[model samples]
Target: MSSNRVTPTEAWQATASRAADCALFFDFDGVLSPITDDPEASQPVPEVLEALDALSRLVRRVAIVSARPVDFLRARFGTLSEVDLFGLYGLERSHGKGETVTEPAALPWVPVVEEVASEARTALGDKAYVEFKRLSVALHWRKTPEHAAEIESWAHAEAERRGLKVQLGRKVIELKPPVDRDKGFVISEAVLSVGCAWYFGDDVSDIKAFDALRARTAVEPGFLGVCVAVASSDETGQEVSDAADFTIESPVAVGTFLADAVKILQANAAS
Candidate 1:
């Protein structure tokens, strides 16, 4: 927890007090799903999903903004139609089971992204796991931590050559189209009309979202922006914790925290 630490109940009460005008945003990995070596195998804790199901109805809106593609997020959250999905760091969006909409600017880069992924797979080989998203490519060195520096250097060089954007994460580097879109851009736009908003995230990339909230709070009178970091042993977790308003232990704690938030919101409504 940072100096801004507030009890879970206090945090919930503040947001629940303005539930009608409040919006909630979350990052899928680490915050909702446990981090795993195999990215494809990660699954969100059912308890968290259960809580989100309730939270969506209580709040003005609920959304998951992630680096994964909207198709991937939709597969995981298809039933939660009330929850909006923003994937590929805001390049994609799906509103409440609606069509997955891609930013027009990014559509032209699909071929380039595919080419990059192919080149990365051949160049990196068994040294890294190359993930191919339609609009981006991510190289993961988690299993072979010793190759982190090598992977990072190669990713940066690739980005420079291809005019792509490089996103660094926990033992991973992603190359995407050079569009000026990111987690911060997503949050800043989403909260424009919101009176109170809370964003939960767990990686270094998530820091942008926290920064977005702080920036908004600074300029918007009577607006509340809560940043909750999910703690882990990884250095990114520490960085996120430092930037966050408070810290929750892990994805398990996130489930409990959301459940508790639901209870507080209900009680406040009844009162």
Candidate 2:
């Protein structure tokens, strides 16, 4: 583990000290699951799921915040009822087996998003993989790196014409409704009553959540927020690590870290 602030052991100890008042937030891809060219094939490591399950019992709340849809997340995390799933960057959220609650402002844009997805597929013509989520669409150029710029340009133009919002990711550009929802907003609201929180992520978009933690720690006395970055190679990875309070190597490392966390939290509770 690498950190500029408190050491990893200290961070774990702080979280353990307030286990019941601390919530943990995680980004699915590159944090729990390894990033894959085929998004559907991405699945969290089995041990990581186990670690999260153990951590869930010790924390106030544990949530997986991702750019993917709720259904996808649920399919993998269905067995872990204590873990909340926030999908589409907080456009939709489901607590355990509960019904998914979508942001009210984004409802009307479903049809518009559908139209954009159709247009994107037709225009891109397999040069890019177009993923059509109900409230958003993502154009992925991971398989065809040559069309990266073109796909990004098309996505931006579509977002502008449709009055949607554009979110950039690794080899992907997503267009969602113009609603004011994101990981930062989600974390800020969830941690309102909590004493401490930690957010783990690997992508640049996760920076917003890190900033939210900083914002909370700045104003809220005695509140502790730790930002953990899952290390990567690209520019986005570098930016994320720079904003993080600490860095871990990969999803596998995340699994080990969470397991270690569970041990400390359990020990602290027993003491």
* Model 2, C-alpha of 252: deviation from truth (Å): 0.7
Q: Which parts of model 2 have CA positions greater than 4 angstroms off?
A: 232-236
Task: Quantify all predictions' global Cα lDDT against the true fold.
Answer: 0.90, 0.90
Candidate 1, residues 1-271, lDDT tens digits: the string is 2345577677777787799999999999899988898999988899989999999989999999999999999899988989999999999999868999999999999999999999988998989999999999999998999999999999999899999999999889999998999999999999998999999998989989999988888898688888988874465456788888888888988998899888999888889
Looking at model 2, residue 258 earns an lDDT score of 92
Q: What is candidate 2's lDDT per residue for 1-271, written digit by digit as tens?
A: 1275589889999778889999999999889988888989999988899999999999999999999999999999999999999999999999988899998999999999999989988999989999999999999998999999999998888888889999998989999998999998999898888999999998889999999999988898689899999974353457898899888888898899999999999999999
Off by over 4 Å in 1: 1-5
Q: Evaluate model 1: give its TM-score.
A: 0.97
